[model samples]
Target: MDTDALSPLLSALRDAVLDGDARGAASATERALGQGVDPQRLVDGALIPAMDEAGRRFENGEFFVPELLVSARALKASQAIVTPLLAQRGGVVARGRVAIGTVKGDMHDIGKNLVVALLQGGGFDVVDLGTDVPPTRFVSAVTNDRVDIVGLSALLTTTMLQMKATLKAMETAGVRGSVKVIVGGAPVTQRFADEIGADGYADNAAAALALARRLMASGA
Candidate 1:
């Protein structure tokens, strides 16, 4: 396919994702494949950028959870078409492995759920630990699964303190350096994340996905 033919398909993918059209996104992905376009071209060129714009809007207050979920679902739809192809072709490394859960003492899950969806959509393998996950479980997951990132969610001021404890546990188990720790939720802040010695903090799901990508790239 000529570059000119590829341009409209890319635009279609971007607009479909911006509009949160999952069916449209999938159709665009399949069509791109039929056109002999590189799968990575669709993923890196269109899908990631669309989600990045969606995240920017979410952070800026122009989009909310509903819009973010819509875009995430759209990305997942497109990813469904691309993943197997990459696997069969070989030499395609997984983006990363992520272990995510609400911290011990937190029962809220809305934000964590969104983060999980977006992380998978971004091509990361995710293990959802449910709400109120304990530090011991996190340590086991890291050591057993060889997790690349540990994402913590805490909705209450009280539960937020567990983030520090969780980090301590990782250090105690000697797994702290093997994985990057990222924290989020309504009560989480960059200052708190720093105090807890976390590797990153995101204000929302899109930001969380971006943070995961960065940490993966940097081997954090």
Candidate 2:
């Protein structure tokens, strides 16, 4: 597809996602592909950029939960189509490997999901451990997955403490130095991350991506 024709379709896909029209987003994505648009173009030009806008809006308070959720859902819908293409192209070559999880006792997933999307968009192979993950599971993922980075999420103040304990467990397992550790949540802060010996801390999903890239580049 010519850039002119592709640009409008890509914009449409972004609008559909931002408008919370999941079906429209899916249809638009498929239509773009059918029109000979590059799958990578769809991802890089539309979905990732749309999510970046959503993240910015969220940080600026221009978007609320409903808005962000709609955008995320739309991105997921588009990803459903693009992921297979990427896999066929050799699994969307990643910059590095990462393991992510919501710390033990925290069943929340929204923050974790956003982090995953941001990381994947930034070209990382991320293994999501889902919610309520124990410290040992994190250690095992690091050891078995040979991940370069570990990310922990905890939305509740009580569960945020688990992030530190998980770090301690990683230390005990002698894998703390093997992988960089990052922590975030509604209650988490850079100070807390520093106190707990985290390699980095992000205030939001975009910052998370930037931090992950920086850490990985530094050979952390």
Best by lDDT: 2
Report the C-alpha lDDT of model 2 over 1-220, residue by residue, as the tens digit: 6777779999999898888788999999999989889877877788767877887898899999889887778777877787656545423668899899999998767567767767887788889999999999999999999999999999889999999899999999999989999999878999999999999999777688899999989997
**Span of 10 residues, lowest total lDDT, candidate 2:** 83-92
Name the lDDT value of residue 158 in candidate 1. 92
Q: Which stretches of candidate 1 lie over 4 Å from their true place?
A: 1-93
Q: RMSD, each candidate, Å?
A: 6.9, 5.4
lDDT of 1: 0.85
lDDT of model 1 at position 142: 99
What range of 10 consecutive residues in model 1 has the weakest lDDT sum?
84-93
lDDT of candidates 1 onward, in order: 0.85, 0.86
Per-residue error for 150 in candidate 2, Å, reads 0.2
